[model samples]
Target: MLNRTSLLAAPALAAALLFSAPAAQAQISTPAASPKSTVTQRVGLTDITITYSRPSLKGRQAFGTLVPFGKRWRTGANQTTSIKFSDDVTVEGKKIPAGEYGIYTIPNKTEWLVVFNKSTKQGADVDGFKDDQDVARVSVKPYKLGNKVETFTIGFSDITPATANVDMMWELTGAKFKVTSEVEPKVMAQIDEKVIKNASPSANDLAAAAVYYYDNDKDLKQALAWMQKANATDPKFWNVHTEAKIRLKMKDYKGTVASAEQSKKLALDAKNADYVKMNEDLIVEAKKTGKL
Candidate 1:
């Protein structure tokens, strides 16, 4: 019963609608309420990373009204707040194995419970959170801040070679937990495996072992022996300077002056003015202290 023109128009109209539907869907955009952030740091031989979302205060009542007390929070706005540790760590005296974990907090007026959950796949609401999957639960005291924080922030404070504090700040309250990584065991392992056991260790390898020992207040006698081996292999100005420093640590001021002078000669030939000046300063100090 349809005419020729009407028949063709029906198929054309269907085609147009099909193409326009995708275009309409593509025009939609989703804006996140909070932005994502990441923080990474190294504590001794361990690497730590934290990924989270930042939500603004927006002048709302924070503690009791918005974020209810005694209830577990996702510790961020959007996805689950995640923390990754490269090695096993002790959290508030509790040992936790190395892995990625979801961070959650139960806020209180005096103290808060920071939980590291083994299950990392969860939403901001934490609908699927399991208490049995908790790797660690640390109790940390909350401190009232003098200045108001506009947005939620997680950062590392009081950083050292072997330790750092992970701080969470929002509104006028802050909570922190200490993270420590052991350096001595790792350093000794590297020294044993790479320097001592290696059949053909390079000059750089010996020098690295010596520097580690010197920096860590270890046996200066062993460090000096390593430095001597490094010097015999390559005789670099830096290694010679390191030998002078080891001698000074050992209170052998005469040896320090001699090694420093040799370092100065090599540095001068290599056009390194910094090492020349450093060795000259060391020589002067040795003479003043040793009466040489």
Candidate 2:
């Protein structure tokens, strides 16, 4: 029933409004109350990552009253916290395959129940967690920290070559669980292929194999032989220091003194104070033990 002019003008007006709107305002650009954060640490040959939202205490008590004891929590603010492992890992002695999982927990005064859910998208809905989907459920004792922690934090501590402790700290309380990777077999295979089997292995490969053997308490004679080969052509002060230490462990204090003297001379030429000090200490120890 519209006139010709009215109908024609209506289309033009709709087009103008579509072009004039301010592009939907771009989500208002504000900071989140609990900001999302991700932390990653390389544990041995494996990489572990955690993504979560950090919520501050803001003078409110975190445990028992606010979060509630014995109740399953999302382990962080906002969306459920999640973790990913690059390789298969053992968490508190329970094996977890390499994948992503949701982190949930139940906090008590003395200990905590840690849950690694197979579902990465699990929410904090009423009775949302299914026990059948849980990959691991471990109990870890909580300890009171010396100082208060205002913001929740997730990090790694007590790190070694093949293991680390994933620590969760909040509100003067902390809990941790161990994550261990199978590193020995992988490293051994690498050494065999790259150094042992290769007839013409590089000096760097030989050095790497020697260090791995020395660190893992393998055959000292083989380690010493490889190290000596690595340093024979182009002697590095650090490598010579390692040779001295290996000889010392084998109870050859005279050989230790000779290698330490050579290493000290080379360290002096390189102006490396740390190696110089190390060589000096080795020489003193060798002379004391060898009565030379």
Candidate 3:
């Protein structure tokens, strides 16, 4: 009986030891906050979203230490990073229509070439990249980073009501691309004239016209007038809240505060997340200016 008991106890102790090793390692490595980051931006008429796992310097040499220079980086990790365009736009002087594509970058200290390939499934390496799948390739100048960034990050900078800059940083290398949010006024004018002439304008037509007037033309009075018409026509239309953003851009802090507050209440009643966020952002801006 003693021998049998000893044999059973020995096996149980070995199993516990085996399980504890992995658990201990996991606990030691896990961080208080996850290291992953994501950036989403709308390009022209297309929506571009990028998800990447951030790497840190952490006492190691960056540039060549972490991400080697002159190598093709997936630009992110895990999944092949992707950029989706809502409409066709010009990148690096080459016109690319609205579509989804994989983003790969060749990193260098002085400059980096941003490649937009039609192949969204291609891996980080150039080995799988197809020459025929190439869309547009642009060379972007790299800038010196003032601070040591531990993790990879991408976001919009120099943001305005109409435009923003998409900033990419990894290791010691970084690049920026200008993004324009407004469609051409000629296009908007055509749409407005056609819609009004042929039939009564719908909510979407008014929304598009308002955006064009506000963003492209910088005509706040016209934009506000159109938006007011849109709200009266369809109070339930979710986009009327966006008018607050235009009001903010026009530097009408008082008008922006009022529009944003009203939009927030309307969005809450309608249960629209996009409008809710827009109103929330506007309210934050209003409070910053002591207008809220």
What's the CA RMSD for each of the models?
2.8, 2.7, 10.0
Candidate 1, 132-250: lDDT as tens digits:
88888999999998899988899998988788899999899999999888778888898899889998778898999999899889989999999999999799998999999999889
**Highest TM-score among the candidates is held by which one?**
2
Please give the distance, in angstroms, between residue 69's alpha carbon in candidate 2 and its true position after superposition.
0.5
Better of 2 and 3 by lDDT: 2
Query: Which residue ranges in model 3 land beyond 4 Å of their true spot?
Result: 1-36, 43-45, 160-163, 180-182, 185-195, 198-292
Give lDDT for model 2: 0.91
lDDT of 2 by residue, 1-292 (tens): 8999999999999988888776664457789888999999999999999999999999999998768998888888998899999999999999999999999999999989999999867786657757789999899999998899999999999999999999999998999999998899889999899888999888888888888888889999999999999999768999999999999988899999999999999999999999999999999999898898
Candidate 1 runs further than 4 Å off: 7-15, 121-129, 144-147, 235-237, 264-280
**TM-score, every prediction:** 0.86, 0.92, 0.56
Best by lDDT: 2
As for TM-score, the candidate ahead, 1 or 3, is 1
lDDT of 3 by residue, 1-292 (tens): 5698899899899999999988877844565232566677754444656666666656677666555789877776555667766666666556777778877888787888788888877776657777688888888898978876676677877765445677887655678876565456546567658544646777777777777777665677877777777877775525556677777777778877778778778888878888778777777887787554
In candidate 1, clashing pairs total 0
Considering summed lDDT, which 10 consecutive residues are worst modelled in model 3? 27-36
Clashing pairs in 3: 45-86, 45-87, 46-85, 46-86, 46-87, 47-86
